[model samples]
Target: MAPTTDPATTDLDRVIGFTIPGRHARGRVARLGPVLHAILSAHAYPPVIERLLAESLTLTALLGTTLKNAEGQMTLQAQTEKGIVSLMVCDYKDGELRGYVKFDAERLARLGKNPSLHALFNKGYLAITFDQVTTKERYQGIVPLDGETIAQAAESYFLQSEQIPSVVRLGVRRDAQGMLIAGGIFLQHLPEGEVGRERLHVRLDHPEWQHVEAMGATMGADELADPALPLETLVWRLFNEEPEVRLLGGTSLARGCRCDATYIQQVLTKFPETERAEMADENGVISVDCAFCSTKFPIALADFVPDAL
Candidate 1:
């Protein structure tokens, strides 16, 4: 059944974790509101692009909270030979999140109003990278962009690369006044053995897993994306039939970017002297703008001067 939203409900922007006790199954639900608006409003992205970015952001929140440490982060990246959407990167660090997309504006404009994922990113490859502070080595998996949406592509990555039975449902739409809203849910069947196995073991035949997946399919976009619907009710609406459904916890997300003048300074110092000189305008001032958040940082040529004292 679809969850209804009340007229007076506030924007819902949080991620919640849950588990099916004894069944060894886990899931996450993400609802976006003002955070999504903040991210998408930074640029003049078309409606389709806005929706795509929203899905990526929702997926990041769902996947990021799965980390064990407070400082861990995960990044999802996609690259394609087609000029439509050349590159896209979405990252979630700790509770912070940010992302950006690179595409051929002319080509994108030619595609018209609504373009399929395949049309937008033909022959693209999706890659997921994990950066945990405690681990000496970072982990990453690469897969082809085979599905109609980003959610489906992620599901393929889990089953094919991680050998886990996973499900992801994402919904994004604009309101009557053209406000972007997005939400998503994710589920994965845990192995009977202990967590964090050295090698992944496929477990698609579990009866409980099948049942959970079936119930999850019944969730509609109206229920998942509507800010009016409380997240607690959504979880119960989907899994109330289970014998031992339990809530792990929940965390709110915001549109966060790590870019700052200090970081941009470091980036500029790395450039060769000639390159630095070339970056300057007629007035010899260097300007840097963050593609993700569109925050501009203007630096004087003297700042790059070596030992001016």
Candidate 2:
């Protein structure tokens, strides 16, 4: 089917944060347009991989926006024993994100179209890492890839590790012209006593939480992927019955990369002289490609020489 071209979604690339103040529920809605296309178009990825990458990017955006104290970067990574798709990583810091997939193209091709998540990444484990730039401290969680989708894996992460009741849904589809569009929404029930301030815990027995989960499940692909459906409209449609729900606000997102000549040079300097020499081409220039943005940078060997050396 041709993708819907709702004017509301057109050119929209932002994450909207919302809250059910009375019910102690908070969530985020993210819709990506040009930003998503630009990232996927950089490489000739298969339709399956395209969809998977879109889901990862959307999930990263959702997680990044909801974080309160994160200063550096958060990464979601998965590796499988099947070798069809060995690794997938999505990195989010601030409001910017970049991700890439490492897969066995030949093996993936043989699996046929629309393979199951397990078929793509059999016996895999999913890991989430938080790198705090200011404190130079790292925290991470690893979970077995038990669900049918990445969203399910993420939901499990919150429930099993963080003890937070969370729900996440991600959608990615191609329009008639083959341009990709994606959207994601996340809902988590706040802890008791205080909404956002209480200790992390799960209370699935809460009546309101059940109602919210049911409403969120009704979200259709068109509703999420359609550019014409404004973020407010989506929230309203999902929880109109709950008048206390509040639309907090939103923030913009874009395709961004931190890789540059300076950063690349610093990395190469750590390599021994023999390794650096081996990396250079005939012109004595080292070439490195940023897998996230697919940007290529070339640096002269002299640039890596330390002044004190």
Best by lDDT: 1
Supply every candidate's count of residue pairs whose N, Cα or C atoms clash at under 3 angstroms: 0, 5
lDDT of 2 by residue, 9-103 (tens): 36467899999976678888998877777788777899999989898899988887765554778888999867588999888887787889989
Q: Over the stretch 1-309, how does candidate 1's per-residue lDDT look in tens digits?
A: 112333366447789899997667899999877777778778888777888888998998899888888788899998998649998889988777888888888888888687888999999888998888887568899988879889999999997878887889998866555666788999998776867754334433567778888888888888888877777788899888778888998987877899899888888998777788889998888999999999889977778757333
**lDDT of predicted model 2:** 0.82
Residue runs of model 2 more than 4 Å from their true location after superposition: 1-11, 135-137, 194-204, 306-309
- Taken over the whole model, the C-alpha lDDT of each candidate is 0.83, 0.82
- What TM-score does each of the candidates earn? 0.91, 0.89
Model 2 root-mean-square deviation: 3.4
Cα shift from native, residue 111, model 1 (Å): 2.3
By TM-score, the best candidate is 1
